[model samples]
Target: MKLSLKKFIKHFGVLVIGILCMSAGVALSKLSLLGTSPISSIPNVISNITAIPIGQLTIAFIFILVLLEAVVLRRQFSWQNLLQLIPGSLFGWFIDAFVRFFHSLPNQTYIEQLGLVLMGTVLLSLGVFLEVNSHAIIMPGEGLPNAIALMHQLKFAKVKVYNDFILIGISLVLALSFTHSLAGVREGTLIAAFLTGRLVNFFTEHANRFVDWMTPATDANN
Candidate 1:
């Protein structure tokens, strides 16, 4: 039991940090004024349109995704999946807070902006690495797609690729319709998408030892 308790604490702590990194990554990407991840593409467009805070819009978007998950899973939707809401909420709030905090910092040059894109990508990849290792919960951004893939008996990778293209395309249409230009979908979106999976895999291979020590808990009730 002591071993289990210690493992839980360590893994939980890592999970919390991982989620924070993901939030920070999103905020940094937004601050760059270049683009954001596909998961955030729609909410970012809506935020630009409604002049609503992106974080608030993200929360709403996450709720919608969670609902989608429920719809896709139906009876298969367990409490474990429902638990995505908590982190989803925090993910939004953290994005807002991070954006507000970093809003003042300027990336005047294209190089500097690119630097942020790279940093955000690294943070995001690292976050996913740690989060998956912790085995605590899924963020709604990925959860919706995962649920869909599960239901359709499709590969998660292929589903995720299709999902991302759809998101970026939708955001492009929305931005063109209202904003008359790309608001949240840009080359950086492509950059982040292209790099994130590679980095996640890279981290998985190189950083395995850092997170391989503890395993997620299992119990009779769980």
Candidate 2:
């Protein structure tokens, strides 16, 4: 029981950090007007069109998308998957709102902007690690990549790249229709893929030992 509690704490902590980091990255990407990854890009596009709060829009859209994914994939519904959305959306909203309060900060010099971008990238990568290590059910956008990997017997990283490309394509169409622009899509592709991919590799390699130790707990639950 003590071992189980310790494992739970570790997993839960990672999960919380991971979800928030992901949302923070998305929020920063949106602020840069550079767009986020494919899954996150949808909410940004909707926010641009409807002028609704991006956080609220994102949360709602993700919930709907998760539902669609479950239906399409015939996945069993899980509370953890649904719960994961809460932190992501709430953190995203907090990021957007927090940045709005400091509008002038993002409008810095090229170097400064680059720093913000890098910081955002780091935060996002941390989030990814946290969430992936959590033994709970995955959120929808993430699940899509996992499903694809499972179906094709490909690496999760490669599957993610494919998913990002899909987002880039969708964002392009949306940008053309809404504002005749694709700044976010372009930037998200170039930056997010590079940073997120590198981070994923780094963490996955370095954390394997730790992950192996936790595997038994996860297996027991299964």
Candidate 3:
């Protein structure tokens, strides 16, 4: 039982780390003055219109999106899925709160800029690792890509291309309609997907090692 408890704690530790990483990624997106992922983009739009923090908007948006997913994908619901939102939203809120404290330090150099990019990479990987491992509910936007892959019987990579392109188009439309700064959409969309894929791959490679290490040893003694 103690072993089980310890394992559980370890799993949760990964999750906690993952959430913090995700939050950091979000904060980086804001700092880049570029737009964010589709989910975040919609929230950004709402934030601009309402003068609300992006995190608050994202939380509310996530809730609605999850509720919609529950309705659409009833049989897919699992503890991992349902519980995931807690960490995700909490991380977002925390990052948002921290973002309030600092915009950026003045007189930063190219090395600092590189460091921020790496920070974003780490956070994106960690968040995605937790997200995939949670085996719980995936965020609606992420889930959508998976669903498309399943329905079309295609590779996730291929489906993701379609999913992201569609989202980018939608974001463009919304940005134009609302007259939000076009910089985020113009600059952020495709680059985010590419970088996120690389980061997620790194996360998965590490996770695979962890999973292998944690697998119970088999023996005939029992």
Candidate 4:
């Protein structure tokens, strides 16, 4: 019941690293000119259409999800849950910074673009795995499903599928409406959706040994 400062710090550090990786992956995917991760699809499209920074839009989108969660969960939602805004803001900032950093990268050929997408997928999956394992903070993209599951007393996996469908659908509609074509949601988005979860599970199964190694003996024992 008591929290351990050391453990909390460790998980916090891991969470930051995961955010960095996820942001990098998102940036690379965008640069590839193929597609973006499903969770980022709407923000990326809106950014392109509205000229607003993707990071700023991402932060806004995440806050909206948090508000929705609060509305749905009502009494079950505690003020402490609002603390997620800090990490969400950090994530959005990182996404913006990485997008700027990768903006000049070249991906001319079809092969090169595909390679970028694949690499981005790996990074995104690894990041999600680490973030989930850390359990330090919840990304709103992930937290929305959690809130829905809690509210409906349904399975998390089922809620997650429903949430992803809703996001993809919204992104598709926005892309078509604003750009008059599919922009952010495309084949690569499908690839990421299909592979990221499997990769996360694979990494999660294999990551515990490394995590244990990094943990202090005292912490491990406890």
Candidate 5:
């Protein structure tokens, strides 16, 4: 029992670190001032036009995504999916906190902004890898895709790619419709979109050693 508890704690630790990485990724992406990640572009654009906090917007958006998952999943949606709200909400708040932490960062040149995009993508990828490996609840950003993959019997990687593209497209429409030009959908957003899914897959393949060290043998059962 003690060993099981210890393993459980390590599992939770992995999830916590994963969430922090993702939050920092989102914050750094925003701080780039070029654009944010695709999953964040809609909230970031809405935040820009409405002057509301992106984190708060993110909470509402995540709620909507969870609902959509229910719709897509229909009979398959379960209490476990609902459990995602806890981490998802915390994920939003974490983003707000990290954004504030880097709020004082000075403006950067185009190259420097791109550099942040690369770094943020790396963090997002690692976050995603750890999150999946931890075998815990996922934020709706990842959860929705997982649902789609399960429902449609599609490859998770391919579904994730499609999901990312769809989100970027929707965010582009929102930015154009509301802002009448552009907002958070930009080159940096494109960079993140291009890199995130691929990078995540890369980490899942190559970075398993670290995650395995942190993960318990019976993690799959838990």
Candidate 6:
């Protein structure tokens, strides 16, 4: 679909807000001291084991996904796909900044920690929905599954689940091998994995209404 200048600006604004929310969600989840989202678990674990910043690892992980997509869908991959790096890098920086911001908050109780995880889940879901609906650029985490689904002619949802499971497995292996236990994959991660997709769908179903409400009357009339 072609976007008018007004619509393009709206979409771009939503996309940026979504990325900020997603980064904040990740930071909150980490602050909960429970676990992060499945996509971020490996990076969190590695960051803990090594001295590398999670943000830098996140960017590296995104590029690795890009490379994997190219390898698996060589015929379909284009240089345009590398454009994901732009937003992905921005997301990584946001994650670092938000993590620092949230680190100052205290989660002193189990209930408080759980609350943080739940809040993070909602923000993460809304962020994903907005980002997907914006149709601006796809994050590498999402793009990998999309590329695989297209290349294999499979369903996107199922492929996404498989992709998440693979990441969870890798996170488990890395955590166990390096940390001698599960570090970043825990109950909260499991909760996020199970609920995030459904929550995204729920938000996506209502996003149109929200956008309509946000659109100025002049734009609507035009």
The sequence of per-residue lDDT tens digits that candidate 3 reaches over residues 89-161 is 8865966875664466321654554445456556766687776664334555676566556655879778667
Q: Candidate 4 residues 1-222, lDDT tens each? A: 555887778788888898888888888887787788888888888987898988899899889989998998899888767878888888889888988898777799988888889989999998887777666778888887898888889999888877887888999899899899887788778888889999998886787885664455546665
| Displacement of the residue 111 alpha carbon in candidate 3, Å | 9.6
TM-score on alpha carbons, each prediction: 0.92, 0.79, 0.75, 0.92, 0.90, 0.91
lDDT of 6 by residue, 78-127 (tens): 98799888888888899899888888676999889888889888888888
Scored against the true structure, residue 39 in model 5 reaches a CA lDDT of 85
Compared to the true structure, candidate 5 yields what TM-score?
Answer: 0.90
- What lDDT does candidate 3 reach at residue 24? 73
- Cα-based lDDT at residue 132, candidate 6: 81
By summed lDDT, the worst window of 10 consecutive residues in model 2 runs over 213-222
- In order, the Cα lDDT scores of the candidates are 0.84, 0.68, 0.63, 0.83, 0.83, 0.84
**What value does the lDDT take at residue 46 in candidate 1?**
83
Stretches of candidate 4 off by over 4 Å are 211-222
Candidate number achieving the greatest TM-score relative to the actual structure? 4
For lDDT, the strongest prediction is 6
- Which portions of model 5 show Cα errors greater than 4 Å? 1-3, 214-222
Worst 10 residues of 6 by lDDT: 213-222
Better of 1 and 5 by lDDT: 1
The alpha-carbon lDDT assigned to residue 84 of candidate 2 equals: 50
Off by more than 4 A, model 6: 1-4, 211-222
Return the clash pairs for model 6, or none. Answer: none
